[model samples]
Target: MKRLYFYTFFTIFLNFYANGQALPITEVFNYVIGTNLGGQGGWVNQNTGDEVLVQTGNLSYSGLLLSTGNSVSFAGGGIDPQLPFNAQSGNTVYASFIFRVTDLSTLTDPNGGYFAGFGQTATVFGGTVWLRTAGTQFNIGINKATSLTENTWLPTNFDTGTDIFVVIAYDLAIGEARIWINPAPGDLEAVSPPTPDGTANLNTTRSSLNRFFLRQDSATETPSIVFDELRIGTDWATVTPKDPTFSLEDKFKDRFVVFPNPATNGFVNITSGSQAPKDIHVYDVLGKLLIKQTISGSRLNIQNLKAGVYILKVAQDGRSETKKLVIR
Candidate 1:
């Protein structure tokens, strides 16, 4: 079978032929699984038509839900109302999310469980992306620099629902950070042998810009899983697939906002309904980098920074919106 479809494009074109230069990965958001965190931030409706289905803003709760109710098992770890993103800090930063792992032994350890995923409170930022269940054989990672050096045992072998990508890249001042999880073709599942040594040290807290949680607190809140597009970049990615301006049934596009969301003092009140021309960028919280300008109208002024959490990329006309700011 053409060598099993060339092992599913060898982990999706292995970064455009290995290093020849590729990973400028950028798309920021694509919540297409169940849709809900678009503006009000809340969604968790997976019973996709088998029975017992609710509709309202497409189901609101916390975002990231391609199918909820089939794999119930993660909740004790705490992070249900925590599907937050919109973060980017200087020098080196990369985040990739495309979950579909319905089940993976509810992985837990020195890093934490439900397939292991932490950052917001760990070594720095977060780490852990490995899954499996027959399908195939694949290994992946992305946390390159910030290994707090805990129980360490980052393994990979995912093939649950299919599109399972979790890539993270960072190289701030040689702090070192690299993570890769390429499993799309037949789904290369990799388990064991690649542990206690994958990447870490994201205890990030210099500038502040942390907020990312997938399986929540483990234990098996499974929820069946099915997430699409959860990108964060500094470049170093591979999960390309874009072609949609409006067609998910089309329902009057044009949405954007950024106000009093856990934010304090500083400046954070960017509301929009029309006016167009809207773009603001600021990052701090280990992923480090800081600032990515282009502002026009509304309101934006986080006052010289200091506290933590920042990410508000709003683009009008071209249709783009990303919110999450907290500086205390």
Candidate 2:
């Protein structure tokens, strides 16, 4: 069934692009099974035994179920090719995700389990945020330019079941990283993680970051953690979990217009009448950001995009608007 769906979608996608037709606009990947494009984008399942399960959960969203034996890695494929954080780009990166343990007691690795985080090949430039059985908590372990250190455990009690949202922002320019955790899905943009839930200084300098890892560490770990809504981007709001109540279209209605909706030349013009938008972002139906540009005029060049549906977001003054677009 999965193969059938993939081929079917692939056929449609290829046909549109091959013939210069625009693709459709839809929400990007949010780890929703069946809807998730990770399998095709580069996510690898490295589980030694059982595979990650797609199941309904406490938060009313689809989630990935994992056992002590399950592991996955985003070090290679799953990320969009247009993303800027790839080691080749040298951009600061931010990652956030929501997760919970079905049974916290199952995480009994005294040595700690590398559940999620980013890392580079250079010994001096990797970091892993993991869970250790000793304290039943999550901690950030960073490898800087010369030294590697682990921060204090997060100020949260772990028992059996609870939902936690984690946001990590790493600035390569300063060689520092920070973490934010929320008990529930709150305004991540407005509500900062409580004082005790974050790290102050991660005294490590990095030159390049290669890939993000998920549960790919010591095998001594035996935890069953479930995760949902994993996001990685260059900014805070881009990686934060979003509420389903609001559609992307609602946020960007009538703000800007993209002409030649089915762009014949793979190029479109963006006009906002008088108020010029400060920023413009182009994303695929899967929610993968293809391009981000600071614009002062009314022209957008999408010559590189395959014919498909896209979402164009424009930011002006303090307001933002989203609109559906097509390309041929």
Candidate 3:
């Protein structure tokens, strides 16, 4: 919340859509792991690896940093969570997270280790979306065993003690992937401009994603970085971060009540507390606006929406509130 206060309302408005909607992603799982948005535990479980979870305010979005410490060679892993693994395939899968690095200067490994990203291992081969130090430049690379091919951004992006947000989406069916970087906080679709969107063609068979890892591959390098707010899901919006205060109870203390929550009939009924909502916006997990309806009474007919999770945003008198809705 400290860094967030520095933003002006104008910048915040620019980050979201005109309707004040953001992060359309469905969010299969968001693991802040006891530090930030604590919940049902995730990578903090130490499913694998020896990385330590330390609490720090230095460039941390959630006051937690996953450190790889110093290594002698290439192989020291930081945070390696193998369980509760996402098996999504067929369409696309996305992974988004925030990372901060102390330095990217000593990293010289070409293709051995990874800092953070997703990976899939099948019976024979595997693929990954990870960050590495290419000389003095930081690169986001992808590798797939099927095509025996690899792709990465050219050496241009550099970082030193900065919090960087990365979002990557992989189409399992077509074996294609695209990456967006440091979108306006809540924006999952914003790509790095000037430079073309980071694109890659993984010459491999599409399979269920088996693992997501954060590692410091080069043992010779002692650079330590921290990762926070890691998420994985099916679409762009599913993995994107959304309304920072949406998850805080105090923020929504006596807001409105969204009923028929697990809407079995695809219809949602909303009742505001004391402050009436001027407009109600419904968006898919990917942050795509499904429908915008004027508040006639206090209900919305969602018969057109498919079965899944949706984000509901209510704007009243220039103030806005968000809630997560489920359609069964």
Candidate 4:
């Protein structure tokens, strides 16, 4: 509500066809905890498009990272509800999230600790993205944040997490990627060169990933960023076209809806779009389909059904408009 804008870059639009629609990340993209138990106790929670802002908790490379003070954040964590966490790489990777810097005075890395982009290994240059504390420019290193040899520091003014927000896209298919800072909302420090019909691929190697890495500066200990509505493998979408003022409410995710939540008996309400032909299906926690129905409008009545925790699937009248819902 500070000052909002919208933009689509050309590098991303280059491969705009087929991508006319972005897949609902919360439905497919998953996260297996990197704990000693090998994700036995780790969790992977699906995202709800209602918010353009999803906060993940702390993250790490191998084995569940118990260190929280200076790591990643998850969208809805238990203690640190909105901290960094999920860090993984799969076939189709498109992780997009919005972040705002809260403080830089007390950083983990005094000289700057790989803000936005950080590769698994320092050898992979141009494989990371980062920003300097209270500084301008998108530090796009061809190889790494510290190694400028393969890095390209695209100068800009947006640096603070709250003052600025970025949407990152990693398409493993064509091996391309992009990170747009305050691209859509004007009057902020957004990285330049907007692309409405382009597609980009990242040179960051080292796959078998785990979570989205945006750690703090190595100089200090606490995080200097605050983010929300972190989406993966999809565009800055407008999932729900209804509620007229919907777009203005939440810009991160505009499609998919979970209704009648906080239920009492065993039914819930779900929908995909305002006026699109949709197919509503119910599935169990084990990925088993319980119900599938065709309907129109952004709201569907999911009345009589057994409840314990079912995954509600919805498909809009478009190509990619499916999402999962938890029945209470």
Task: Indicate which candidate wins on TM-score.
Answer: 3
- Candidate 4 lDDT over residue span 1-328, tens digit each: 2232223454443333212223343311123323211111122222222111223353211111121322223221112111122333454344444445555555434333344442332223223455443433222222222443333333233333433334455444445445543333221122333442123342344463233333332335334455433444323442111223324334334345566665555555554325556556666778666676666544455556554676554534221223345455
lDDT of each structure? 0.41, 0.50, 0.51, 0.37
| Rank by TM-score (best first) | 3, 2, 4, 1
Off by over 4 Å in 4: 1-92, 106-111, 116-127, 134-148, 159-161, 185-210, 220-223, 234-328
- Compared with the true structure, what per-residue lDDT tens digits does model 1 show for residues 86-165? 33345554555554544455443334333334344323444445332322422334442234343233332334444544
**TM-score against native, each model:** 0.26, 0.48, 0.48, 0.37
lDDT of 3 by residue, 1-328 (tens): 6566667766764443222212232222333322321113333233334444434332223211232221111135443433235355686766766666565555555553445444554123334555566445455555543232365542224445556656666667887666655443323333322222356764656575544555544454325665555666666555553554444353344356788889987577776434454467787987688887767576788999989898886644323346789988
In terms of lDDT, the poorest run of 10 residues in model 4 is 59-68
For candidate 4, the per-residue lDDT at 320 reads: 24
Ordering by lDDT: 3, 2, 1, 4
Worst 10 residues of 2 by lDDT: 75-84
Alpha-carbon shift of residue 110 in model 3 (angstroms): 4.1
Tens-place lDDT per residue, model 2, 67-105, is 122112222112221111345235566676656655445
- What's the count of clashing pairs in each model shown? 62, 15, 14, 98
